[model samples]
Target chain A: AQSVTQPDIHITVSEGASLELRCNYSYGATPYLFWYVQSPGQGLQLLLKYFSGDTLVQGIKGFEAEFKRSQSSFNLRKPSVHWSDAAEYFCAVGVWGGSQGNLIFGKGTKLSVKP
Target chain B: DVKVTQSSRYLVKRTGEKVFLECVQDMDHENMFWYRQDPGLGLRLIYFSYDVKMKEKGDIPEGYSVSREKKERFSLILESASTNQTSMYLCASSLNLVQGETQYFGPGTRLLVL
Candidate 1:
């Protein structure tokens, strides 16, 4: 069985400040990773994904995530966060070569951007 | 743009009542999924269908049933709704396994059972 762990339940950062959300996963084989964001009363939107290749993968909305196999982690980061970036972020792990398998997701981290 | 739509945004029902939630995808995706979301529990898959008329039980599919007669439409059914089933239900669709399995989600249906 695979599982995802997001250590931070909530994070607050000032506008224009760097942000990092931690995510760790337990999987046996090469892992497929993804980041998703959801605003209040809205469906989740994909932020980024990592199958294989470069450790650092860029995503939509000026967000990026780095996959560290040694640490069993895929951390989402942004050099600077805008006020609009405040939302709930989730890290998910896909099973079976990213095939038609269920995704295991973290509890999610709520991000708040301070002015 | 890929679009996934759910039948309802909010639903209130009584315990032991039968419930049906519909999901449709306009992108012709072959894979559809149903998930329940709670405050502390992010998303737990209830059921998924890789092809029309073929369904698979997910991690938490105890009281849920699903139908996918058409490729674009998937339905999740509760035999008898309970208080524990009160949660936000999300629908998602994705391309076939050959394509990267990045799912696009619907707005979600918030179901409350009294």
Candidate 2:
């Protein structure tokens, strides 16, 4: 069984500060990882995904994630946090070639940015 | 850009009432899915369809059913709405297993069963 864990339930960061949200996954083989963001009262938006390639992948809204196989982690990072960047973040792991190909997601981390 | 739209953004239903939630995607993707999101529970798959008239149970399929009469539309049905079913329902679509791996999501329908 595949699962995702987001260690931080909530993270508060000041504007212009660096942000890092932690994520870890448990899978048997190579996994497809993804990060998604959801604003209040809205659906989720794909931030970035990693199939297979360089460890570091860039995504929309100046977000990036690094896949560390050794650590079983795919951590999302931002050099600077903006007030508007406050949202709920989720880490998901995809089952490769599964018939339905559904994603298993973490509990999510709520980000709060202070002005 | 691919667009997935849900039938309603907010819905209120009474206990034991039958409820229908519809989702449509313009991307012509072959796979459509239904999921429920709750606080601290994340997204749990309810049902999925790989083709028209075909449906498969996901992790959490109890108290729910689905219909995929067309490739572009998927409908989730609650046989008897219960308070426990009150949550945000999301719809998603993606290409076939090989070509389209990323699932595009709709704005979601918030269902409240009283």
Could you give the TM-score of chain B for each candidate, in order? 0.96, 0.97
Q: Please give each candidate's TM-score.
A: 0.95, 0.97
Q: Which regions in candidate 2 have their CA more than 4 angstroms from the true location?
A: B98-100
Q: Could you give candidate 1's per-residue lDDT for residues B5-54 as a string of tens digits?
A: 99999999999999999999999898999999999889998999999999
Worst 10 residues of 2 chain A by lDDT: A95-104
Q: Quote the positional error of residue A30 for candidate 1 in Å.
A: 1.0
Error of 1 at B31 (Å): 0.8
Q: lDDT tens digits, residues B11-60, model 2? A: 99999999999999998899999999999899999998989999988889
Best by DockQ: 1
lDDT of 2 by residue, A1-115 (tens): 6789999999999999999999999988888999999999888899999999799999999999999999999999999999989999999998754555668889999999999
Query: Per-candidate RMSD vs. true structure?
Result: 1.7, 1.3
Clashing pairs in 1: none
Worst 10-residue stretch by lDDT in candidate 1 chain B?
A: B94-103
